[model samples]
Target: MKYLFAILHKLRPLFPQSLVNYGYHFPKAYLAARLYGNPGADLEIIGVTGTDGKTTTSTLIYHILKTARKKVALISTVDAKIGRKNLSTGLHVTSPNPFTLQALLRRMRSQKIRYVVLEVTSHGLDQFRIYPLHPVIAVLTNITHEHLDYHRTMGAYMTAKLRLFKSAKHAVVNKDLPLFGEINARLPKVMFSTYSLHESSQLKPDNIKYFQDHTTFTLGNTFYSIPLTGEYNLYNVLAAISTALLLHVHQSDIKRALMSFKGVKGRLESIENKRGLHTYVDFAHTPGALRAVLTNLRSLKKPAEQLIVIFGAALWVVSLVVYGKRLLSNLIVLKLST
Candidate 1:
């Protein structure tokens, strides 16, 4: 299948982009689904997509549903799961090709998994890799500058992300994003709910507090706390919570799940050394994500402590370098390594 894709790439110059997408990739995805018995049709799928926080948000939604005793599975950039069994993604890509994705979904369907929380990507949406699954709930964490190398412009990138909502029955959105209005306009028929720090949102956090090891906030009159840090993480929590509520999960169950939830790996993950120094492992590649992680770390630092950061690149390395330099100049002791 991969070889076939490679051969198709050679014909890129002879065909238009839409033709290549519809003729080659779309059919490939559909064939993969047919071969896998159309597993996505047997399960309720939820797709989460954004420039940042897709993994964490998807994981959070998975955890919440699992804790509530729903048979749930998750597929994210970092890992994939079926019931209690977990596996590393093994692929560098956030969303794998059609054959791989449909096969995984088929396995989950065989296990009678009721729900799947998937981290959808723009590349996957544009390529029609997720064409077999129409999500019951689609979440947009937020859209920002990302993947411009392939999409070529911010508008195109956003259009790719918005594709998820087109087939979705309901949507959970970040009210704080400028794109929210446009997304709402586009999905006028889709049931929409929003979360934000602002008072006007349907679900807003109150009494927010961030500490070294955990953060606390209130949604309505119920207080909830999570072991994850960062104000941005609070948004992630809100996103998950809103989805749970939309699914009709009990508020008590939501609180219980969140309270017991540990943070996602590689997203603001903390490591401690014997000398009591702390190191963090994070998959924050975008400017907004990098800034959020650093800002959270700064708040957690003692007055005299020094914060050192290490970064690696993924989609937009050059843009990350430029943004990192500008954002971290006064925030951390800057160190660059090639």
Candidate 2:
């Protein structure tokens, strides 16, 4: 079957795109689920999807649950944690293929893992790859300009993301995004639990403070501090805290988890050096993400220090001019090489 799929992949461009997706990928998902007895049906699943922040939010949710002494597993773009084992899902893949995904779910079920935080992508949702998994909670970080080439329009792209929320029993969404208004109009208010940084929502932070190495905020009258920097990261933390609270995790456990959780790799990851220089590596692909990352770094750097930026070309045809303009707007005393 692996060879058969490989052969079909080689001939995929020859067939109609819909036929290849619905005909080939659909059957693969169904077969994998049937073979694995649809393990997800018996598990408490949280599906996290958006243009960004999925990994951090999912991992944080898993961390809070695990810290609260719950048997939880996490499958993010960074890695998958099943009990004590850390397994690589794949290179450059968010949600694994149907076979690997279902197999992981089966393993989690056998181990009595009650909760699974799975980071899903728009492509994974649209392709019917995760067709058999029904999430109890769906999380949308935010939707911005991305992946328009495949979906052809922003409306189509947004619709693909909505599919996950439609399958979920409850949804946690970012209320600050304009997309939130659309989501609110479509889904029932009872199904939504919102979090926001600048607007009134169910979960809004207060008394926010930003530092070079960490951030402090107040949620639900309890002050929380995280070893992560950036306002965007505040949203990620809020998302996790909201989900953890929904699962009945204690606020004290959530505070401890937020303090201990270092962060995900390549998502504003700091590299230690002996030279007393601040260096970071991040997985910022879009202009909005680039702006957020740079904005945080600029706040941390000294006025006299030169901020150096080095980035490469994107694999897809993004508006390089817009990216460049965003980068330039954040540059003060800076050196840029692309």
- In model 1, the clashing pairs are none
Measured by lDDT, the strongest candidate is: 2
Displacement of residue 271 (Cα, Å) in model 1 is 0.9
- lDDT for each candidate structure: 0.84, 0.86
Clashing pairs in 2: none
TM-score of each: 0.90, 0.92
After best superposition, candidate 2 residue 125: deviation in angstroms? 0.2
Worst 10 residues of 2 by lDDT: 329-338
TM-score of candidate 1 to 2 decimals = 0.90
